[model samples]
Target: MTNILTRPGLKPARPFFSSGPCAKPPGWSADKLAVDSLGRSHRSKIGKQRLNYCIDLMRDALSLPDTHRIGIVPGSDTGAYEMAMWTMLGARPVTALAWESFGEGWVTDAVKQLRIDPVVMRADYGRLPDLGAVDWSHDVLFTWNGTTSGVRVPNGDWIAPDRAGLSFADATSAVFAYDLPWDRIDVATFSWQKVLGGEGAHGVLILGPRAVERLESYTPAWPLPKVFRLVSKGKLAEGVFLGETINTPSMLAVEDAIWSLEWARSLGQGGLIARSDANAAALDRIVEQRDWLGHLAPDPASRSRTSVCLTVAGADEALIKRMAALLEAEGAAYDIAGYRDAPPGLRIWCGATVDTGDIEALGPWLDWAYAQAKHAN
Candidate 1:
């Protein structure tokens, strides 16, 4: 146990740990980014080449199959997901599974905005709904990992191998951290800012052959926004998947993503997953040794390897706020407070970019901050 009155002797070299726009890769520097694409039209030869290269890099990183088409969309994960929902949903019965904030947002979109009246299945934070009870006849929407609650589906085994409906996964935090079963997923969305720690404002949407068929065959009851349109003359817009974006994208952000993606390619998908697993394990070891600290998601099989949420003993919103503030003030951690919608505690980013040594160093600081906050209260 650490003394409440004494500070930890050692500090993390890089203390960045936000769930979104997470810590950059080791040895990353802004000067290393390829700036040749900056200040150039996204449609220009070099710009298009860079964008296409980014897509290719991501495809290789994920081992995504040729059956899926990847495109760089306008908004981050939210935009890419909404585009999928607006365009491909309502073709059949729909089922929406929500266990966290972002998942609930998709439910709202389906029931309220799209007015699809999807069969809603929900669970409390740190828990997952009954996957076995899902109806495969209905199109299924789910988050691969619950970023806010730190819960995740154990694997794609729950998805029916032969199903009438499509599967949509909001996989922003799970992409690089897990080995996703591409054969089971019909559609997926993610942003560069999550595991890769690239700049935001751009999203990547992946559509399987079934999703593309839905786009070409079935038209939605509602009007598609110009930015959301994936079809031209009832044909899938092939150019969009080939580096032709639906709208203008920040070339600088694109370059930044390229740098991160290149770094990811160097490590390979298994390497990225290994890094995240190691960081999460390091945090888990700290939690095991501490009586006051515990994981929000109790099930180890379903617990998230990234965006790990914790439960502090006898903690309240105020105590958590104070503790987080104290750690931030000490330069020991940053942006580690749990999500506002979630229960009060700590949420640490253990993604591929974060070093396990930093997570190990965070343990003592957490004890110090918790003790200080408790004494103050």
Candidate 2:
């Protein structure tokens, strides 16, 4: 794919707002990626140190506990989830709560691939699974933020106190933007692409004490792939989360992710999260003032701070398409179209990189484009 921002004399119509593989940090320079790692082996001392540095910084920036272990693995968030499932899922029956695409994928894996009997709890897009309805006695798996749907679990209070089962969270899009209840989550996974605005293709796995106990106690029902093998035969893989990746990683991507994390650390983690919340607030204000738009997530408390999904009321399909096209044509925004599986509307990435001023500007732009779309239709 061509660099969407590189068109001659045609500047970005507006700041880019795609969810994954987001726009690069404005201050990022190519010089940082040109280091001499292209020729070195990943297992070498320097490579190990580089990976260690990345994980250490990540742990610190996210305020993960010292007892928690982090693993840098090959597949983007998906791989990390699979690895966790394979290693830690058989201690009890699975309870998979799904409200969006990524959560559905996890349910599929649990039932089909692992051949494990999982009690599936599902909610339509733009809503959350009934956390109260779930039986927390079983090993629980769910997403903290439903990126495609713009919905999220409001808090971790639904988790039972002194619950016997472990909690596995696919927090790919929620990590930095939301206050994750680390005590409630046992295994958490995230990718660099979401809040940090880094390149993709790597997954970070954070494991708590309960998660480690699961790995050390039970074996998976199926055979493990080299990539998915965390507890092999009987031993826990200690270094995998530290610096020993399952396979080769894009050093360039690692470096870029490190840069983004450093940027987040410098900005202060609380400030970075506040910035995303402020951006979402800006978008919410737009939704409130205009009768033409409404948020897909009905509960204001459950709405996402990262991915903000909106739908136009009293607008035909042609109008939505035309409005999206108009924004793209003017370089006002890209990748704002709603997911194909979802009701037609708009989905904006309102994460840390997105400026509140830019989000505020979108209200007027939407008004302009909607009018044009209505006229054309």
Candidate 3:
């Protein structure tokens, strides 16, 4: 039990720790939108330039090779991934790796919606699927970071570079915060709402040379939604990759994405990654010492630096919920509850946009909230 009076006096200056729609850049506000060319048509000269800027900024910041094509798509990361899956998957035997909810959702899409005969490799929440046994000759689909389960592939070492298959990775929560191997990933998808701390409704799709070749050569068995069609008349759509969106997009969100990218540039990729690493280290100090709480991912190497999920030892779901609710009511944290389908505990966002000071501040609040919940119960 913790004494209420002894509860740490410090609180996070920013308490916006939701896994999605994460915290804004260090100094972000609507005032930063002054430069946005709002009220203009998306296809207008200014609007198109703004959209293209978002693409270029991310490409340069994330250090994608010149061989990769970047595009802004609708419906966030889901739409972008579905587009790639619909366009390129059936051309080869597919393997869908599942360790968390989103990865499982992809498995469902392949098996049920696409009706493709997919080899599904699944694992328990905190564990990663076996990387060594995967057939690299088949198209491989997986999430680089398991946001819901707290497990993440440490690197791209598991991927075979010379394989016949294309790797499609859903890196929505992993990008920007972690160093992703763009060379190994043929098709990658991420939403602005994740690590970048931008508004949603749009997703960034990165297509490597191999992924583009598939788009140009292979056609889907089913009709692609207008938004999901990446190719037309046997050629990659030139306009789509150059900011001619499938539908109207929010200019404000586009500006926000641009702003976030600029922030990343100012800090540099290494600096941005360091911020997340520091936050994770801050969390580890408290969690490692506490026997009551442990990381959901038992393997420290597989633990995600971005979405640091945890499990409380000997605590039931109700107690976990109560602790989260109490923390929220007292304004110590927000959206810190574990993903609904995951083991009940907490899912703290330790991405680059989050200040390490804030994460350090969070440690005591969790302790205070835990004691309060246990005593009240």
Candidate 4:
């Protein structure tokens, strides 16, 4: 067992692995800000430049086509998703697919908020929505990766070739880490603080041709908040994607996001994906070595490369709590506990920011923590 000093008034021994607002960019320094934009209006030329740079780098990293409009909107991923739901959903029948919290949020908004007649397809926390049962003839809403459950859609093969309705995807956790079939996705939204390790105040909205067409033609039934209004002057506000916010944004957050995007560009998209996959594979190796533990996601092929969730088999709630507490006390890990709504499991964010060395160190720490809990029992 690793000699981890339990609670000894010391800091955490290794990196944390919670899902969102995950670990800061590796070696990121707060003092790097040369000109702070705290007091400046977001409409200023400098502010717009920063905003546009972030969008451009994001597009380059994601390889988004020039035809698609990218918008930096409010409310993180949730805001972008709600805006899309309210703006373009009334024209067609909506189908919502949910297997985790984020997806559930979209479903709730579709059914209650927008009052859309939705075909709800759902699954337990550890499973995925039945993709086969989905009718793509209607506008479909789904999350590419279920962050809480560590499950993801393996590919876009399930999407229909001749489907008329748009496919709205909440790809918050799947953006850079997983391969997104851009051709099939319409209004795909993600946040900066996810896989790319950026600040978490803005949502990145990518509107494909079909989604933009819907936005141009349909008028929402509800009142549009000034900030959520993307179609201003009867045209899609094209500048919003480049950095213009419908309302003012945190310039500091915007700068940090730009910095993160620059970092991603240096690493290249393939490198970013490789980094995430390697980190996840390292965690899988640890899981393979342990017989008492297993992945929370049933199928190996459906596992998430970003959010690595695993359960302690035969380990009850009390034991799991003890193990988690001991690990935190030892300063080996923190926030490794699974989501409350999810099955008892440790959810680790093995995104681009997390190093494989940290994950390797966590393996023995888990064994030690488990042993300590079993011995105490």
Best by TM-score: 1
lDDT of 2 at 309: 87
Q: For residues 1-377, what per-residue lDDT tens digits would candidate 2 score against the true structure?
A: 12233333333434688888665655777786646665677788878888898898898788888878999987899999988998788778889998888899899999888878899999998898779987878999999998889999998999876888888989988988987888888999999999988888899889998888778788766777889877755767888977988899888888888888888888777988998999899999989998888999999899998888888876656677887898888777777877766777888898988877778777767777777777676
lDDT: the better of candidates 2 and 3: 3
Per-residue alpha-carbon lDDT of candidate 3 for residues 259-333, written as tens digits (9 for 90 to 100): 989999999989989999999999999797788889999998899999999988667888889988888887879
Q: Evaluate model 2: give its lDDT.
A: 0.83
Report lDDT (CA) for all predictions: 0.95, 0.83, 0.89, 0.82
Ten-residue segment with the worst summed lDDT in candidate 2? Answer: 1-10
Scored by lDDT, the top model is: 1
Give Cα distance to truth, residue 374, candidate 4, Å.
Answer: 3.6
What TM-score quantifies how close candidate 2 is to the native fold? 0.93
Residue 138 C-alpha lDDT in model 3: 98
Worst 10 residues of 4 by lDDT: 4-13
Clashing pairs in 3: none
Task: Note the residue pairs that clash in candidate 2.
Answer: 13-331, 13-332, 14-331, 14-332, 71-241
What ranking emerges by lDDT with the best candidate at the front? 1, 3, 2, 4
> What lDDT score is found at residue 302 in candidate 1?
94
TM-score of each: 0.99, 0.93, 0.98, 0.93
Candidate 1 total steric clashes: 0
| TM-score ranking, high to low | 1, 3, 4, 2
Per-residue alpha-carbon lDDT of model 1 for 1-377, expressed as tens digits? 67889999999989999999889999999999888888889999998999899899989999999999999999899999999999999899999999999999999999899999999999999999999999999999999999999999999999998989999999999999999999899999999999999988999999999899999999999999999999999999999999999999998888888888888999999999999999999999999999999999999999999999999999999999999899999999999999999999899999999999999999999989999999999
Model 2, position 287, has a per-residue lDDT of 92
Please identify model 4 stretches exceeding 4 Å from their true place. Answer: 1-14, 34-38
Of 2 and 4, the candidate ahead on TM-score is 4
